[model samples]
Target chain A: MINATLRELSVALAAKRISAVELATLFLDRIQRLNPALNAFITVDRDKTLEMARAADVRLAAGDAGPLTGIPLAYKDIFCTEGWLTTCGSKMLSNFVSPYDAHVVERFKSAGMVTLGKCNMDEFAMGSSNETSFYGPVKNPWNTDRVPGGSSGGSAAAIAARLAPAATGTDTGGSIRQPAALSGLTGLKPTYGVVSRYGMIAFASSLDQAGPMAKSVEDCALLLNAMAGFDSRDSTSLERPAQDYAHDLEQPLRGLRIGLPKEFFGDGMEPGVRAAVEAALAEYRKLGASTVEISLPSSGLSVPAYYVIAPAEASSNLSRFDGVRYGYRAPEYVDLADMYRKSRAQGFGEEVKRRILIGTYVLSHGYYDAYYLQAQKIRRLIANDFVEAFKHCDIIAGPTAPGTAFEFGAKSNDPVQMYLSDIYTIPANLAGLPGMSLPCGFDAGKLPIGLQLIGNYFDEARMLNVAHRYQQVTDWHAQMPKGSA
Target chain B: MSLNLDQVERIARLAHIEISPAEAAQTRDRLNAIFDLIEQLQAVNTAGIAPMAHAVDVSQRLRADVVTETIDRREVFQAIAPEAEAGLYLVPRVIE
Candidate 1:
């Protein structure tokens, strides 16, 4: 039951084989037993979750159930759930409980999905690994000593460990896809503005997007169908018509063009990861999909460009969390200025402080032209590279990360090495194109290797279709860690 | 493109955060390394290419200027600070 996919769980519920309350209890129990080892969740309210489950069961009884009507899902701590602790994995928001639901949360509730709990994440969704989370890092379920990838590490870890059937994650510069890659889960980051961001606490406003992480691409598709839509509240939300992301899941891959970017397959890619991605491409070819070697030359510069642009935007968005607001504040201060200084100093983690400083420095008057402005220009070029590549293929394929999940603290001392992990994933964010990472094969140490599928702007349905077909032919995503729940 | 310790301190101050001397030194080294990598972008000629800010070329949507609703300031400020005796965020006096 714990390892069942979202679609399976929904079918079981509809058939009266299991009640939503029973399923919720099973996940809550799994979370209670396993979260201590994984630290994947920051908060799990049994009362609220059971209440939601009860409501879902009632809806199911009335035959008002949808595909996700009774499935349990975890929310990354960043998305605001009214009366729930939406900490955003920062001490600054430690005591903050949102008064209203984020658009995503409201949509999920309307679908009658059970909220298992809130997963942990990096503070302000700023870090590559989950290490920067104030709550502590999430352990990869595959190997406890390794990281689960991050700012959506908790979400990935939870789904990987079967703590939740599915979970929601937000990506800003590779948070969702990278972590999903490391943890061997199917995670999707839809095109920017496809999912409303009204109450998902802003990190890098332009780059931030919320999506689903689950056991299969089909599950991710169902979650995406519920999560993606137009919302007037979020100024950036696309006012496009509703989409059935799962509509083309079983579409035959005949005549599909998959672009393999030369830069992605070149240096910096681990031998094992390259082998796994190549093998996945071979399988796609068997399914009648053709591959073309293309070049995203500007993709090599994505990491540097993203670090500057994301942080520059982060510095501006995070300004709202001053001492005067409804978050952590210094207990004692000599004056207002002292209050601001002490509050921020005590509130933010080391990585958060480092980014704030870097963001401010780059956006500062003297350095803006040299750093921020140049990064913005490079961002355009990176996006253009995708535009050019897409003209030749329906989707681009690559390794989500350069390598599999590294041991904890392996690259913690070196920020640049850690930043480079997002090299393949960052370009998608820069282009505001939808991207996904699905388990393709295992590495030498048995860590999961992810094959990334990137779609053109608003091409989520096509991307999911490609991923679904791949999952249909391979069992890599079905392989779970050897453990007793 | 390299940032010295002094420059790091100045940047931190400009950003309105306080950093210790040790952290400033560390940040300087890290930022310099990152800047070195970013320097590669300068090699590309972006002449006449309008910098793209967003993926979609759509213009920003405009909304009517009419007020849809209003919030009570007193209630809004209620959670601004731990102690809000008045309709304001209470803080220690800064000015002399």
Candidate 2:
């Protein structure tokens, strides 16, 4: 039952096979069992979870429930959940209770979904590895010594361990897909602005996007249907009509053109990961999709360019968390300036402070044109590369990361090494294109290697279609860690 | 392109993040490493490229100036402030 996908859970829910409260309790119990070892969830309030479940139960009983009604899903702590501790895995807001709900949180609430709990994340969605999380790094369920990828590490680890059926994650430079890749779950980052970011803790606003992470592409599609829509409140949100992301799940891949970027398959990739991604591509070929070698010339610049832009945006966006109005305040300070400095320094983790400093430096008067403006120009070049690549193929394929999950401290010491893990996934976020990752195969050590599929802007349905077809003939998504069961 | 301790200290102040002297040395090394890594981008010819501010070409969206959200819950919002007096967040004195 814990291994069931969202579709199976939805069917069971709709048919009254299980009560909403019962389902929430089942997962809650499993979470209580496994979360200690995994650290997937930061906060699991039984009272709040059960209370939400009871409300969902009422909706189910009244026959006013939607497809997601009674479904229990966890949210990454970045989203502000009214009355719940909405820490973005940072001590700055660790003790802060939100007064409002994030747009994603409100969508789940309206769908009658029960909040399982808040999942852990990198502090303010900063790092590629979950090690940056102040709550403690989430362990890869496959190997206890390895990390689950970050920003959405908790959500990914939760799904991988079967602690939760599905969850929401935010991606700013591969937060969703990279963690999804490392944890061997189906992670999607829809085209920018598909989901509103109104109440999500801001992190590089331009690149930040919320998407679904689940056990299967079909499950992700179902969740995306509920999570996406136009919101007038968020200026960046596209005013597109709502469409079922699951509509094309059964579409044949006969004429699909899959682009294999020559850059992603280069020397950067581990042999095992390259082998797994190549195997997935051959499977697609058998499914009648044709593969083409495409060039994304500017992809090489993605990591450096992202470091400049994302942090610049983060530096500006996070300025809201000063010591006065909300969030952490220094316990001892002689003056206003002293209070602000001590509060931020003490509240934020290492990576967060580093990013803020870099952001401040780049956007500073003498450096704006040299660093910030130049990164934006590189952003344009990278976007142009995707535009050129997409013209030749329907979707781009690659290894989600250069290698499989590594031990917690392996790349944490060097920020550059950590940033490189996101190389393949970052381009999509840069271009605001939809991207998804799913388990293709396991490496020598048995850690999962993900095959990433990136689509043109607003191409989620077609991408889901392609992923669904691959999942149909393969069982990679079905495999779980030996002890997880 | 590497930042020295003084620049790191200045950047920290600009960012409103206080870094102690011991931490400053390490922060300088890390930031300098990153800056060195990014220095490669300077070689790309982007003279004619228009800077992309977002993934999609979208202009700043505008709405009618009518109040969309009311500050009616101002107190509720400030309830979490570390110190508040009469619904005002109390910070260290700005005036001498």
Candidate 3:
């Protein structure tokens, strides 16, 4: 039951082999047992979750249920679920219960999926490791001492630990892919405008995209079917026709052309990780998929440019929390100005405040032309590099991170080193492309290695197809950490 | 490329936050390390390149000039800090 995929779980629900309430209770019991050691969840309400499961059962009996009906999934704390604590993993929202549901939450509810609970994350999605979470850091289930790659660490950990069958995650500069890589799960970040960001607490508006973390590519496809859609509330939401992401999952990749970016294989990658990724590429070659070396010269500049662009947008988006209408406010202040100052100072975590300051600095007068404008031009070059490279191949393959999850606090004090962790994954986000990380191999310590596959804009189905084909010939995705069950 | 304490203070003020002296010094060192990494972009010859802001080249979509009903200001201000007995967010009296 713990290792059951979403498809198997759906079949079980339809056959009355197990009810949604029973499934939710199994997960709730597991979470109650393991969550203390993992710190993967921020909020879990047994009563509320069972209530939703009962509703899902009713929908199933009514014969109006969808594919994901009665399946349990966790939500990243960033998405505001009405009446649930949507803290965004920060003190500012620690006490805040959202008055309305985010667009993604509404879609999931409409599909009749039961909520497992809200998962932990880095505060306001700022840091690469989950250590920056105001609540606490999430431990990698594979090795409790090792860190889980984050800002989506909790979602990845929850799925990895089998506390939930699947969970939602938002990627801005590799948050989704990195954690998924470290935790040995499949995570997908769809095209930027594919998922609506109506009430998902803003991090970097242009780059932030919510995607799914699950056990397999097929499960991710099913979750994406419900998660991706057009919403009029979000200005950037794409008005594309609804797609069945699972349509091409079983397609053969006999002649697929995979482009391995030469720049991604350059120095700065751990030798063990490079070996694992190369072995994965060899498997692809054996599967009748040919590989070619392509150049994305501007890929080296993605880290620098992303830091500036993401923070600039983040600073502007976070300015809305001024102790005015919602979220956290200081208990006492001398005046309105004092109130804003005290609230922000006390509410935001250190990393969040640092990003806000950097963002405001780059976009401020006199610096905007020099810093913000220059970063914008470089962002275009990075996007164009992908455009040029995609012309040569159908998909791009690379390592998700430079190395496996490092020991916690190894680079905590070194911000530059931490920022470089997302070097390979950021360009896909910058280009508004779809990317997925699938478990390929493990390092010497049995830490997981992820092979990243990036596709052209709105080509998520193709990416999932390639990943699913690869999974058919390998058992890496099915490998679970010792003692998880 | 290292930022001085004064510049950090000024940036903090412009960002509408207050920082302590020791905090500014620490932030200066951290920002210096990050700025050093960002300096890599300076190596690219981006002269005469048009700055791209949004992903797609599109103009802002404008909505029709219709009167959208406004929410009750009094109700909204009810949650506002420093609110007085009336519908306003009260601050200390500015004028003597």
The most accurate candidate by lDDT is: 2
User: Any idea how many clashes model 2 has?
Assistant: 0
Number of the candidate with higher lDDT, 1 or 3: 3
lDDT of 3 by residue, A413-465 (tens): 99889999999999998888899999999999999999999999889999999
Give candidate 2 regions above 4 Å deviation. none
Whose TM-score is greatest here?
2
Report clashes for each candidate as comma-separated counts. 0, 0, 0
Q: What is the lDDT of residue A381 in candidate 2?
A: 88
Clash pairs (backbone) in predicted model 1: none
Winner on TM-score (1 vs 2) = 2
**What CAPRI grade goes to candidate 3?**
medium
* Fraction of the true interface contacts (Cα pairs closer than 8 Å across chains) found in each model: 0.50, 0.88, 0.48
TM-score of each: 0.97, 0.99, 0.96
Candidate topping DockQ: 2
Q: What is the descending lDDT order?
A: 2, 3, 1
- lDDT string for model 1 (B1-96, tens) is 677888888877666676788777877888787777767876777776667676567777898998765764557447635667656666776666
lDDT of 2 by residue, A1-485 (tens): 88887778878987889989999999999999999999999999999999999998888889898889998999999999999998999999988899999888999899999999999999999988888888998989999999899879999999999999999999999999998889999999999999999999999999999999999999999999999999887899999988999998999999999999999988979999999998999999999999999999889999999999999999999999887888889899888988989999899999999999999999999899999999999999899898888889999999899999899899999999999899999999988999999999999999998999999989999999999999999999999888799
Query: What lDDT tens digits, residue by residue, belong to model 2 across residues B1-96?
Result: 878899999999898888999999999999989998889889998999889998788888876878877659978977888899987878777786
List candidate 3 segments past 4 Å from native: B62-96
Task: Arrange candidates by DockQ, descending.
Answer: 2, 1, 3
Q: What lDDT score belongs to each candidate, Candidate 1 first?
A: 0.88, 0.92, 0.90
Predicted chain B of candidate 2, TM-score versus the true chain B: 0.89
